[model samples]
Target: MTPESARALAEDYFNGGRPHPLDIGVYTFDAGYVAWPREPTPGDPTVLPDTVGGACIVIDRHTGEVSVRPLLPPELVAELWPDPTPR
Candidate 1:
C-alpha cells in the first residue's frame, strides 16, 4: 500500500493514529471455510503464499477501502487516485 493509504487507514482505525507496526494484516485463501472467530487470524499474510488474501493490506475503517498495490504504477489504481503516494 502507498504511504498515504496506510496513513488514511491508520487515522480511520487504531484511534486516529498509527496502526501498531506489528499488527500485520490477516486473511485467507479458503473463504469457504467458516472461521469460528470472524476476524483476522494468526496465520495472516504468511500462510497462503500463493494467494492474495494472504497478502498485506491496509483498510479504511468506515469505507473498507483496501490497497494491495504498492507505491508504484498500476493502471487501475492510478485512474482512481492519480497520485497514490507522496514520492
Candidate 2:
C-alpha cells in the first residue's frame, strides 16, 4: 500500500467513519484498522490486497503509550513522536 492512500484512509476512517481495522498479517501494530475493499482481479488471493490502508502508532512495549508513528519514514515518524534513542 502506498503512503498517499494510507494517509487518505487515516483521515477518512480512523474514528469509526469506515469501520477501520487495525491489524494485518505479521503486522499487528495498533488499536485501529480498516479492512478496506477488495479489488477485481484474476490472480491468487494469497497476495495481500492493495488500497486498504490505515495508520498505526508505535508505542513503548512496556509503557503502552504513543511513541512513534510506526512503519513510516524516520523523519515523518519522528515528527509524530521523538525517537526513543536520539543522537
Candidate 3:
C-alpha cells in the first residue's frame, strides 16, 4: 500500500488522546497468502506442497517492502526496530 494509506491505518493507534511521544515511523501491512512447493511422503495422508498457517502481510516503509510470515523472528523484528531496548 502507499504511504498515505499506511499513515491512515496507523492513525487509529494514535487515538484516545494519549500522547505517543516518540518518533516511531508508521508501516503498512498489505495482507496476502504465500506457499512453496515441497515433496510429499509416499504414504502420507496430508496433501503435497504444504501451505503455511496464517496469511502474509507486506511491511512497507515507503523506501521498500518486506513480507512477514507468521511468528516474525527476532532478526526481522530487529530490522523493524533497530533499537529494541525499551526506553
Q: Pick the candidate with the highest lDDT.
A: 2
lDDT of each: 0.35, 0.39, 0.37
lDDT tens per residue, model 3, 1-87: 566554443343323254742222443233311211123344766655344442223344544344444334324443444332413
Over all chains combined, what TM-score does candidate 2 have?
0.26
| True lDDT of residue 44, candidate 1 | 73
Displacement of the residue 18 alpha carbon in candidate 2, Å: 3.4
In model 1, pairs of residues that clash are none
TM-score of each: 0.21, 0.26, 0.25
Off by over 4 Å in 3: 19-22, 27-75, 78-87
Arrange candidates, best TM-score first: 2, 3, 1
lDDT of 2 by residue, 1-87 (tens): 333444344444434445754333122223322223223563887888674543444433334344323344434444444444434
The prediction achieving the highest TM-score against the true structure is 2
For 3-82, candidate 1 gives per-residue lDDT tens digits of: 44545454444334444432323322211110111224557755654323322233433355665434222233344342
The TM-score, computed over Cα atoms with residue i paired to residue i, of candidate 3 is 0.25
What is residue 61's positional error in candidate 2, in angstroms? 1.5
Local distance difference test, candidate 3:
0.37
